[model samples]
Every structure is written in structure tokens, then in C-alpha cells.
Target chain A: MKNFGGHVLFLDRADINTDEIIPAKYLTEIAREALQPYLLESLTLDGFDPKRDIPGKQVVISRANFGCGSSREHAPWALEVNGIRLVIAESFARIFRQNMFNCGLLVVELPCDTIARLFTDYARGETFATADVARGVIQIRTGTKAEEISFRLSDFDRQLVEAGGWLEYADARY
Target chain B: MGQTVAEKIFETHVVDRPAEDVWVIRLDAVLCHEITTPTAILDLMRLGKDRVFDPSRIKAVIDHVTPAKDSNTATQGKVLREWARRHHITDFFDIGRNGVCHALFPEKGFIRPGYAVIMGDSHTCTDGAFGAFTPGVGTTDLAVGILKGVCAFRRPQTMKITLTGELPQGVFAKDVILSVIGRIGVDGATNRIVEFDGPVVQRMNMEARMTLCNMTVEAGGTCGICYADAITADYLWEHIRGEYPDKAAAAADFRKWWPDPDAVYEKTIVHDVSGLEPVTTFGQKPDNVRPVREMEGTPIDQVFIGSCTNGRMDDLRSAARVLAGRKVHPHVRGIVCPATTKIFSEALEEGLIRVFTDAGFCVTNPTCGPCLGMSTGVLAEGEVCASTSNRNFNDRMGRGGRVHLMSPATAAASAIAGHITNSELYKA
Candidate 1:
């Protein structure tokens, strides 16, 4: 997995659906790789920018039960294929989050301070350093001002986070 | 603190041992329909799989194509028919005996109280009417279940949905579910245990219970369950009376299939159905509801009479009753598609179909034809229709075919009225 030891970004309080991520008609076809373009179509209405870059400072922080309904695997597929760093929500749905883990995507839950730091740096495209996955503390350095964000990953999930996905972990296991 | 028998039965299935936060459980039954069955079976063949874990544990029925007119659906049906014969998979399939999978399962006793079941169709929540932990799964999940004999499940936060008092005249189970959908919008009950309670629920039959639980997918819940009682046991025993010797013994154990009175629930919702009428949803959402008495003169062009959600004997009979003597309006095109071949023949025997054909309505064979725009009945652009199927999201029935989801009775009334009208208007 590509390492982003000290980068952070944020998306606050948006509950996304698969229809918004990828419409129903698109699911009629068997091919899944072309799903990255339709993200937030139901919410954004017009469309989402496809050229948005995310090699670093990438994460989505949102409110409860993100990716709640519809067992469509495209929601996680679009996010993973488009290079989203991590989805740090208040919670996640069972099937959708599992799909994310299967595809080797990271979903982190961070304290409010860390969320704000991640949010600001991501929105402004300015660099914010949040390099503390161990010791349960996140340090976000936004230029001169630095904020400490709290976070933790369970041992089982840490392997997913480290290996970049469950399929990778399972592949390595075999 | 008043728990229904359905809640009690589920508690018995709860397997909360060490390190497991109740994420999965063993299944009592498994169901698959034609659309996904081809692939599920194909996957098994690809893996060189032979003989499922349990033949009696599985059931396959043709649903998507009944009035198999074209060579394609007929061929698809033939492939599945051969699979059933070779495997002896509790064959319930019939062109004549067929109905929508979700609607027929409980009618056939494939779903019952405390049963842990999984189905490939999204509408598997329909079985929850029998007080079972029934939910829909994708082909991958079903194939996985087909291979391993089990699948994972996350125990949901319990929701106590109490229906108070009696329903007003003409307001059936469809109205009750649509009312709940209206209150909760679409996503209100996601990942929660929706237990139907109160006096209205108590008085309801298993079919009515099935209707309420059938569309739980619209509200996005794990599944909806009614407490299994003497009523449930009696229905189950009576349906499979001649077939099984242990049927009586199973029915006698109703008390074994319910929740304890002191069961814990994550949330509770109460519905007072004191005054409601035949309701219908316009626009692109199922929760978009209005009383049938209210939809007078709302211009409609098409009326779809089929789908897994409302395709059954009773649903057809109810619609036929409303359309008996009346002629379908000149402007309104009434498209009637049966859920299965049995319902088609039964309707023909009853002369209910003659009533439809004489009234200038189009009677189609058993298929999801117009309902899903798969084949048969296709809708035109900018045309508004009153449909009996679930989900009116965008143009699901056809391209730009504005679908207004309603009960069969309501659709019948709308067909006669030349607009979205109440079935009560045509009665008597």
C-alpha cells in the first residue's frame, strides 16, 4: 500500500447512496470498472469532477451509517478505484463496509479535532500533517497551527488498513 | 414491555458467544428464483460442484417469465426446469402453479416463524411476514450460501412498530405499509429489526402480514416480522396439511416461536390506523402517498397490473372485483400481467379475465414484463401510470414512463376513472 504517513483530508456529514455513487441502469451491465464517474450524481445532481486528484491528503469524514442501504458493490468500487484514501465515518453499514474491506479500502474513525484538521486541509488543498496512527493520537499540522486528533484501529482491521484491503490479506493468507 | 411472539422466536436464534457480536447465524431455509438461479447454478457447475448440502433445504421457482411467449424466457424456464428435475430441489415451480417468489413463499409455507432464510431476490424481506429472519442477497451471497450452507448476518437494532386500532374502510395492508413508508420516508428502518405490533397487526392474516413485510425494502430494513401465534401455526398447518406427517406437530409449537415479553428493542414507532383510505404513491418514490379518494382527475395514461410485490391470487381477485362491470377508459391503456401461470388460469376460470378483456384491457401471461420493462408491456415517454409493483423510482417500468405505485384495487379504479382514482368509487 502507498504510504501517506502525515496527510489528512475531510468530508463532513454527508450520507451517500449507491444511486448517487452509480445509478441503477448502470448496474444492468456486468462490467464494474466504469463506475468511478457517477459518484454523488443523486446528491450533486449535475455531476462530480472526475479529474479530482488524490495521491495524498485523502479521506472522507461523515456522519452516522454512511453507505446505509442497497447491497450494490459499486459504491465502494467507485471510491476505491478513484483512489480515496480513507472513509472516516461515525459508523458504517455491514455489507457496504465489508465490500470496502474486501476491496482493500480504509475507513477510519477520528475525534472531532482530527476531523476538523482533516476537513480544512482537504477543502483548501493546503497540506495538513496527521501522522499518528499509533498511540491513538493524530497530529495535524496546518502550517504554523498544529492540532492533535484522536484515533484508533482494532487489531483485525489494522491488518486491513496496513495491507490495503481484506482480499489482499486473504490472498496473502493463502 | 409488550413483546410479540415474533420477537420472542428471534431471541432464541440469537447466538452471541465470545468474540462474535451476533454477526451471523444458521439458516432454516433458502430460496432462489429464475433470474438469479441461472447464474447461481452456473457458478456451482464452474466450481465442479455437485449435490447441494440439502435438497429439502432449497426451493427454486420460475418467477420472471410465466407467460413465456418468446423463445428466450421459455428456454430460460426449460434450463431451470431441468435443474429442478435433476436435483429434486423441492420443486414448487409451475407455469400454472407459479406466482411471485416473495408472495408465494409464505403461501406455500417455505417461510415461517423463527426460520433463518436467505433469498437471491431483493424482495426476500417479504417472507418476514411469517415472522422469519428473511432477507435478500446478491448472487455472490446466495452462491456463497449454496457452497458453504450458511452466510453471515449482523444482528440489527430492534424496532418495535406498534399499529394501533382498526383500519378505516378500504384501507388495506398496502395502505398501512405505504403509510409507514410515508412516515419513515424511504430509509427510516435501515439495519433495524422492525417488529409489527398493536391491535391492527393482531387482527391481520398472514397474507396481510406478508403485504406489510413485503415492501420493507422500500424502508430499507434487514427484515420485518410479525409475532407468530395460533393464527400463524394454523395457517402453516392448514396449507401443508396433506403433504407432511409432522405438520401438525410443527403447528402445535406456536408458543415456541415468539419473543419474550422483556426483549430489548433499539427503537419503537407507533401507527394509529384509525382513518386511512386506499392510498397511492405518485412521482418517483414509494413513500409518496395520497388517499385514493383524493386522486380524482389526476391524469393517467397506463395502468400496470403486475409484479412480485403485489402479484398474487388475492391481488388479482381484488383488482378484478373493482373492474368487473366497468370498461377500461378509451384513453387509459390497462396492461394486466400475471405473476405466475396458476394465477393466469385461475383468473381465466373465474371469468375475471373475460371481465378484463371485454373491458378493453390487455391480459398478459405471468411475467414481470411491464413492471420491470423486461419484455411484454413497455411504457411510452411522459406517460403516467398507476402500478401495483413496488418502487416508482424514475422510469423503472419503462423509459420516462411515470409510474405511480398503488394497490391493485386502486390501479383498477384508476383504469376506469381514466386517472388515479379510488377503487371505492367503483364499488357498488
Candidate 2:
């Protein structure tokens, strides 16, 4: 089984695109690790600086349509190399969601109302989330308050997660 | 239950049913380009598994930054070239024959109705214009498809978008798609296959259908399909003539892939576009669209008239019609790139290249350079451009550069006026 728990970074914006996640200019680079320093470098969110905000963050909490542009896997690879493995959003673009699972990362989709409430309650303070895949619940808490949110994963996605990605899964099956 | 077109395609291609909704599908084609395929090749090499399942089913190209901008890009192209040669992939298009993968593959008649196709580029859905079940995949899935000829997918729901009326004058397929994206938000069709039909689609040519389907990703759609009809058969006549007795027979055979009349759709949207005007994007998102009249006179520093979205022969002719007796503005720089070498030659033979050159526009070889900020026309900081390509995300064409998406005609008119202007003014 796999689990995700860490300092939550709240990006309160909708339609964060692949170009903003990892710009198209750096796509020529051959290795995934080379994409680390450029993650979210083109993002124009108000009051969000990638240099300052990306450090010490292990999870991302964002608005709807996270990763909406290009189908480049560099976006998720950038996040993985930076040691951030979990993303919580109201919704996600189709290709981005599949890429995350193919790389053994987890993206949790919540209702729009629940995402709005989470932002209302935790956007101002230092918040943390522990995703317990076995328990089917995510515990979001600040220093003084706490809430438990439930999410579901499909059987195939769970299999991909347990196998540590598609390559390993194909190794056993194919 | 009646199946949608996507469901029928999935049913036909299913190799295994791994889970309730997950189907391991056998892919009929795999498209590769320089930017994404090199990573997959490296990964396969690292794992001691560097072989393709079927060389004939693979189509490779060096399109993203052709004739490479730097040593890094050149090495990426080298890796793909070596891999293709080693695998005996004869369909690989090198520098001289290269074009945008989506436009090139369809023009060659490599896609067919009900066939399953996948690529590492988002616009792979452009092939859905031929009624193929095409979706963009990451490197992992792409590598698997290249090796084992299969990938997995969840059963997709269908969203029926019935386009009702004929497009108004000066409004092309680009405007129709932009208007659809504007009505539905960016995420409106997430996890769904958009099936576009009704009178308007039935009359559109293959190039126009491709323009509509190419931007399906912008609305978060997995694929956008048009039922194969006489138009599709006509486009594929040269390639399919040997297999069929006549064009009508081939079209009749392709009609079997259409969705049943009582097909179940997750949602249905209707749009009457007869009164629709030319539209453009105001913000960075593709869905941040408005009518051209709303954002008129927005000064632009550059104009680009080519990409997978609107870089076909019809797109070039439309722009040439507008620029026939005009000149590019003194302050605005203009660039025109045909989508393929074949398109370039066709435009040259049609005297369209002369119209562009005589109007002070710089026409270059077919490349996807300026569309993605890779090369050829990178903008300076704080500069704005009127573009005919898809995706206006922040810094898409350059750092701190703004891109307003429009049709080629509008882009040509904007180039002449040095600002965002509607193409209707130049129409005779």
C-alpha cells in the first residue's frame, strides 16, 4: 500500500496549466531531475513565488482543472523529483490525472463545495494532510482544528499505486 | 443499452477487462515526435528493454523544433532517428518531410474509423476527426504501447454537442470551436468523449472537422469525434480506393462506426452558431473567450498564422484572401509557417506564398517552433501576439508574452492593422 502525508501548499487558483507547471522551453532537457529548478517557474498566481512556496511542501491543494494544458509528463515528473507526491483538487484535467497515476503519484478529487470549504478553513494557517489510503480518509488539520475527508480510488488505480507505476505493472503482466 | 461511438471503439479494441471499467486496449497506431519519444526510448533502454512491438504501426517525426535549436534538442532528435532506424520504422519523417504530427498523420490517411490511436502529444485527439478513438498519453503509457502494443483506459462517457446552424461569414471553424469552449467552461467535458454532430458538422470538410476536434483537449475532453460520412470517405479516397469498389461503398462501410440513434450521452449541449461572430481569447486560458467586437483595437506586437489547429490549406487560403491587397503594419512583425512541407509546396503553387511575401510577412519552412516558444519567433517580454494556434496559457509563446487566439483570417487582419481587429472589415 502507499500513503501520502506532508505540509500542504494551497494554490487557490483554477485552471493551472502544464505550461505553468513546467514551461515548454525546458522540455528539450533529457532527464527528469533536470526539471526540478524550473517547476512552477512560469506560474503567475498572485502572492505565490515558486522559490519561496515550493520548499518544504509535500502536497498541493488547488482549485478546479489542475494541469489543463499540454499532455507532457514533465509536469508530474517535476513535482515527483521535488518530493511532492499528493495533489488535492476540485477537479483535474483528464491526461494529467492519468499521468499522475502512471507515475505512482496520487491525486484526490473532492466536490467543489468541499474544496471551497477546505480553502476557507485552512488557506490562512499552516495546514497539514495525511492521506490514509487503507482507511479511505484524509485528515486535514491545523494547529488547533481538524477535519476528516473521505475519498475513493478505482481498483486499477489502486493496483497501479501498489505496483509502483505502470512499468512495474507491465513487468509482471506482459 | 445502446453504445456511443467511443464505447463501441473500446469494445472492439479490448484485449482484457482488468477491472469493472478499466479495459486493456490494443492500439492500432502509435504516433511519436522528438520532444516526448526520446524520454520513452531512454526509459526503455534503462530497463534493458528497447524493442518495438510492430514497426509498421509506428509513425515518428521530428517536428517540435525541427533542424534543432540547440545541441540538447539535436541530441533528442538523434535518439529518435536512431531508434526508428533500428526498428525499421519506415514512416518516420525527418527534417525535409516532417510536419506537425497530428496534421501529417491524418493527411496521409493513417487513421481510420473505429481505430484506436495514442500519442504523447495532447493534440493527438485531432485524429478523432476521422472517427478514431485517439487520446494523448504520458511517456509510461506511450512506452508500453510502443513495446506491447496495448494500454489501459477507463470507459469514457459521451457528451453530445449538436451544432445546429451554419457559421456566419468571416467566422471559420476556429471561431466555432472557440465559441463552444466559451460556452462550456475549461473543465466542462472532463472525462468525457465529445461527439459533435448535427447539420453543421455533416457539411464541414475534413480540415474543418479537424480544427474543431483539435481543441477538444482545451475543454478537458478525452476525444472529439465526427461520424464518418461522404466527406471523410472523399478525404481518404486516394488511400482506400484499392480496398473498395467506389467512394459510396467506402463511406457506407464507415457508417457502421457511428453511434446508435438512441445512444446514451452523459450530457447534451446545443448551440446555434448562425449568429455567432468572430471570437478571440482575452486571458491566458483557452476558455477565456469573447467576441472579437468586445476586444477590438487591442494592440499586438506580433502575429503567427500556423499550427496543428489552423495550419491546413484552407487556413492559408483564408489568410491570403485577406492579405491580397494589404501590407503588414510597420510596428507589427508577422510570421507564416505551413503545417507541413506538402502544405508549403501546395501554397507555393497556389501563389499564396507570394501574397504573404508581398504583404511584408516572413514565410518560413513548416515548423511548430513559434507556437510553443521553441524557436523562430519567440516574443520579447511584455509583448503581445495575435495567433492562430491553440492554447494561450501564460508564457506559452515566450516569457511574459501574451497570445490572443483567433482564426487565420483574423490573425492576418490583425497583422495589417497592428492591433486586434475583426476580419469582416476586409471581406468583400
Candidate 3:
């Protein structure tokens, strides 16, 4: 498994729906590649595309009980299509977080200080490193402060990460 | 373990055996419309199932792309009719019987609270208003549900949203949900059981509750649920009591499932919904809440009150109450499409038809006649109309028309004033 880590784009808040991630109307007409145009399009008028986001693994920090809404797989599909390696939120919606992990999307939950470092990273481009999974703590190093962010991964997700995506894991599971 | 009303239901409907290891709650009811049914029927055929598991549990309605917009629609409608007949599915809503599935399901009493419901279309979650645990399913799940009566998945965390205080006058349920979306952002309700309670939630009617719960997914809630109460009992009794000879027996089955006071929730959010104004979603999403009273000179060309979201007798009655004596503005097109033929007949009987026609508004036969972009009442380019439908996606109702969603009362008053206004406009 690739133990990846990076800076965070902190959205430390709640209630991100599938429509906001990818509008329903588009589901009928557009292909998955076109989903990049939206991503968080509704979040902002000139929204950032979910695809072609930051290169390589990146951390997205969010606030309490995140990812709640319809069980649309498109949200995580868009996130994974982009380079979002791991999502560190206070919590994740049941279906959304699972959908992400099922599709080999990684999610990590962290405490407030580790979350605060995410804000710092977004502000100052300070990089965070995730090395050891046995220790749930993620190491975030800024110019002034280096703090540890705690995260936990289920066995299923750890297996997905180890096998590198579900298709590979399914090769073994089946 | 303390469980919210939603959690209790999920636990009951757990997929597979009664063992706790089952993650996804198996769905009880499966709903389908024209757009998604075509693929589902094909998949059903591929599975070599000549007959459905249970006709009563599965329903097919032709709301989307119905009314035969073009040559393709004619073919599509015919195909759908033949498919339904071949499958021996009794519940069929032709264009004449057509209305958005969400609106008619509850109006007709198919969507009961605490039941696990799934629909092919996204707005299937709209039924959460009746305290029912409904969510949208995809093509594969639709077919699977028809054959096996269940779909699998992991359990979701439960979040309790306790709304206190009364809504500020003119502030409808639509506004409350929008404000919630605004407060928590889109992913706030994600992967969690959303149980709405507190004084304000209890005060909402079935229509209002539907409006609130319908958008549970919009707030990122897994499936929205309201505690089944007297309101739910009254609605069921009034609508389906006659059909169920043993009314008490039918009602008894639902009571045991509702979440008790000691229910567990990941988080409890309290919103003081005292002074919020009625909101209109001018843009694509339902969270686009703007007070109709202050449209700020945004001229509206039409007002629509229908669809799965807010097209019911209560919605029509509320709108009619606002427009009883007031005439619709000459510049605006006031259109009302009841969610079902039953609602249409009832409204016509109750003098709502007179109110609409006299006020220069029009009421059409039940169908997904307008919303979903397959409407005879297509809006002109750049024209804006306040709607009561579930979604306001691009060209959702018509080509180049800008749609804003709101409560039916807001649509009615706005229609009378030629702009977005509330019932208060009439008194003023």
C-alpha cells in the first residue's frame, strides 16, 4: 500500500450533497470524465474541478459528520478521479465514505489540532506526512509547528490500500 | 444502544439474515419511472425472470419523459405500457394519471413512515417527509430490488436534527431545509441517519414534512425520517383507511418501528427557526434559498406548483388559500399540476379549480406534465418561474428557462403578484 501524505484543503464544515458534488441533471447526459467541470461547482460559481485537481495524493480536511446525503457514488468517483489520496474529515457520511473506500478512495479522521494544521497547510502550503498506519497519528510539519493528527482505517480499507484498488483486491477475494 | 427513529428502522430492515453482521438494510419498496425503467426492464429480462417477486411491492410510473414530447416519446411510452402489461404490474400511471412519483406515493399511501423505500430516480428520497426511510437507487439496484426485494449496503451513522420554535411567518419548510443545507453545507448530512424532531418539526404538516424530508439527501442525509405521529396516522387514515379493512392492524405494524427517546445519534443540531423567511432556489440546487418577498426586482414570468416535492392536496390547498380572491398577475403564467388524478378530482370538488381558473391560473391533468423538462408549458428562454418540483437542474422543466423551487404557497402568491411574493402580499 502506498502510504501517501500531503497538505490539506480544509473544508471544516458539513452537509455536502451529491448535487453540489455533481448535479443530478448532468448524470443523464454527461460521461464520468465531464464530471470534473463540476466537482464543487455549486460550492462556488467558478467552482474548482474535481479532476485535474492537485497532482498526487492530497488530504482534504472537513468538519463534523461530513459527507451526508444521497448515496450517490459520483461524489467519491469525482474525488478519486482527481488526486485526492486521503480525506481527513471529522466524520463521513455512511454511504459516501464507504463508496469512496469501495472504490479505493481513502478517508482518514483526525482531531481538531491536526485539522487546524490542515488550515495552516492550505494557507502556507506546509506539507503533512502520513507514514505509519499502526500509529493512528498523522505527522503535519509547518515552518513553525509540527503536530500529529490521529486517523483510523478499517481492515477492509487497509486491504484495499494494500491490494491497490478493489479490482486488484477482488482478484484475490473472489 | 440508543437509536434515532431512522436508526431503528434501518436495524429492522437489515439485509440478509437477522444476524447483526449484515451491513446494508434490505429495501422494502421499489419505485421506478420511465427514464430508469427502460434499463431496469431490460436487466430484468436478462435475469430470465418472467415474473416479478411481488407486484404489490414494486410500482412503475411514467413521469419522466412522458406525455410523448416527440416521436421518440411516443415509442418510449408505448414500450413502457407494453412492458408494464407484460409484467402484470397493476400500478401504472399513464400521462393522464401521471404525476411525480414522490408526490403521489404519499398522497396515495404507498410510502409509509419507517419503511425502507428505494426508487430509481434521485428524488425517491422525497418520501422521507412522511417519516419513511426512502432513498434513490440505480438501474441495477432497481432490477435487483424487484427480483430479490432487497439491496445491500453498510450501515450509516445517525444524526439527530432537533428544530425548535415556530418558523417566521412566510417561512415554509423549503426554506428550513435550505437553511439547514446552508448551515451544514452539502456533505453535512452525508452517510448519516437524519432524524428531524423538536417542536418546529412536529408542527409541520405531511406536505411540509415531505418538503422538509424530501430534501434530506440534499443536506447529505442518508435518508430523512420524521417520527410517525398523529399527523401521519391522520393522513393514512384519511387516504387509505377505507382500503384497509383492519385499519388498526395496518397502523399497528408501523408504530413499533419508530425511534424511541433513548435513540443514539452521532450529533444533535438545534436550529432556532423563528424568523427565517420563505426561500426560493433561483439557481440549480434546492439549497438556493431566497426569500420570495425580496426577489429584489427579479421579474418572474411564471409560477408552478407541482412535482414530487410539493404537488399534493395540502400544497394545493395552501396555495389556493393564498389565492382565493386574488387574481393572478397578467404577466405571470400560473400553472398547477396536481401530483395525482385523485388530488385533481379532490381539488376540483373543493372549488380549488374555480379559484385557479378565476385567478387567471391554469390547472392541468396529473402528469409529470411540467417538471423534468418534458412539459407542454415550457418556459421561454431566460424566463424565470418559481416551482414546487424536487429539482431545478438546468433546463429541468423546459429549454432555457430558469427555475427556482419554493413552497406552493410561495408559488401561488408570487403568481398573483407577477413576481416572487408570499401570502402576506395578499393581505398587504
Listed per prediction, chain B TM-scores read 0.89, 0.99, 0.90
The residue-by-residue lDDT of candidate 1 on B1-428, one tens digit each, is 74544344445554432123334345677787666565556656765764465778888887665656466566557766777777788655766677678766676777767787888666788787777788776555565555555654544566878999788766778888998988886667776768898889989887678788877777767778887775776778866566546655655564455666777887788889987777888656667787766767789988888777677777778888888878898999998876666678778898888988887789876766566655666677788888888777655655667778888888998899899888878885
The CA lDDT at A130 in model 1 is 40
The first chain of model 1 has a TM-score of 0.68
What is the Cα-based TM-score of model 1? 0.78
Model 1: how far is B424 from its true place, Å?
Answer: 2.4
For model 3, how does the per-residue alpha-carbon lDDT over B3-87 read when each residue is reduced to its tens digit?
6666677678874432233345566677877665565565456546545667777777777555666655565566567877886
- How many clashes in each structure? 14, 0, 32
Model 2 regions lying over 4 Å from their true place: A1-3
Docking class of 3: incorrect
Tell me what TM-score chain B of candidate 1 gets against the true chain B.
Answer: 0.89
Q: What is the DockQ of each candidate?
A: 0.16, 0.84, 0.14
* Model 3 spans > 4 angstroms off: A1-174, B17-22, B47-51, B75-79, B167-169, B238-253, B282-285, B377-381, B392-401
Error of 2 at A140 (Å): 2.6
lDDT of 3 at B354: 92
Docking verdict class for candidate 2? high
